[model samples]
Target: MKKKLISLILTLIQLSVDFSIVAASISLVIVIILVASTPFTGFAHELFDYHSWWSLVLQAVTASVLVFLAIIMFVGVHSLLRNINSGLYFVNQNLVAVRQILWPSLVVFVLQSLASICFRL
Candidate 1:
């Protein structure tokens, strides 16, 4: 029963990870489109209160970096999940995958905190 329950939980996690990957991909595309169109549309100014082209550029770069990191993190999580599902729970590859996810997540956290500070100022 415990094995079955664990399997069910892992299956649910895999599904969640798959959905997150798709969502993150879509978000990346949308960020790219919005950044590409911002100069011409002046939407960033209205929406984000961007004061200048430099601010918009900074926002665009930050957003792109964040999204890219998120994608990397998700990919790492998928890999880790794959390893777990395969019954390779304590493998080196899983450690590497965890490290991959960890670095990106930490970077994302730092970047977000910095962004919040900058915006608030």
Candidate 2:
């Protein structure tokens, strides 16, 4: 019964991970297209003044980058969880997978902090 309960919990977690992957994939694609087409979009130019445009672009780029990073992290986590569910949770590769999920957020936080300090001046 204990094993059955553990399997059930893992199964639910896997399902949640699958849904998150799909959601993250769709969001990442949409943001990528938006960032890519920024130069070509009239809304980016005609809809805002120079400073406003620059700020908007900076924010958009930051968001796009974060979303891209999140997608990578999500995929890494999905792989790690799948492996764990398959009974290989203690392997060496799991460490790499854990790093893949963590390093991007740390980098993003550092970049965001720097950007805030620069903008404050």
Candidate 3:
């Protein structure tokens, strides 16, 4: 039980650290986009040209979701995959820690899946 708690705490730390790093990188991209929004009036015009505020809002939301998924894929999921493979043969030794990682991953997967579905139609 103590070990499980220890692993849980460690996983929480790892999750926060990883999330902050990924979010920071993606936020930089959004900053770039917002910065360019001023000079690239043409691009911004084209983006909001749909004439529907809802469409612009939806596009912005979609971009954010896509960026989020990319970060999860590059950082979170990739790291989890590496950890899984590394401990696969000895997983019984670290099942609790793996579970700690998986709960958030499943949530991330579901959210990303929901985001992608909106783009289908």
Scored by lDDT, the top model is 1
RMSD of model 3 against the true structure: 9.5
lDDT (tens digit, per residue) of candidate 1 on 3-121: 88998898899889889989989988988888888888866667655867877878887898898999899889989988898899888999999999999999999999998898778
Tens digit of per-residue lDDT, candidate 2, span 51-87: 5556657756776787778777877787787788788
Off by over 4 Å in 1: none
- Candidate 3 residue pairs that clash: none
Instruction: State in Å the error of residue 71, model 1.
Output: 0.9
Inter-residue clash pairs, candidate 2: none
Q: Estimate, for each residue in 31-112, the C-alpha lDDT of model 3 and write its tens digit.
A: 4574446344556446443444454556555555555545544464445544554445365435555555566567667766
Top-scoring candidate (TM-score): 1
- Compute the lDDT for candidate 3: 0.57
Query: Local distance difference test, per candidate?
Result: 0.87, 0.75, 0.57
lDDT-wise, the better of 1 and 2 is 1
lDDT of 1: 0.87
Estimated TM-score per prediction? 0.89, 0.76, 0.39
For model 1, what is the alpha-carbon lDDT of residue 16? 97
Which regions of candidate 3 are displaced past 4 Å?
Answer: 1-28, 35-40, 47-49, 84-121
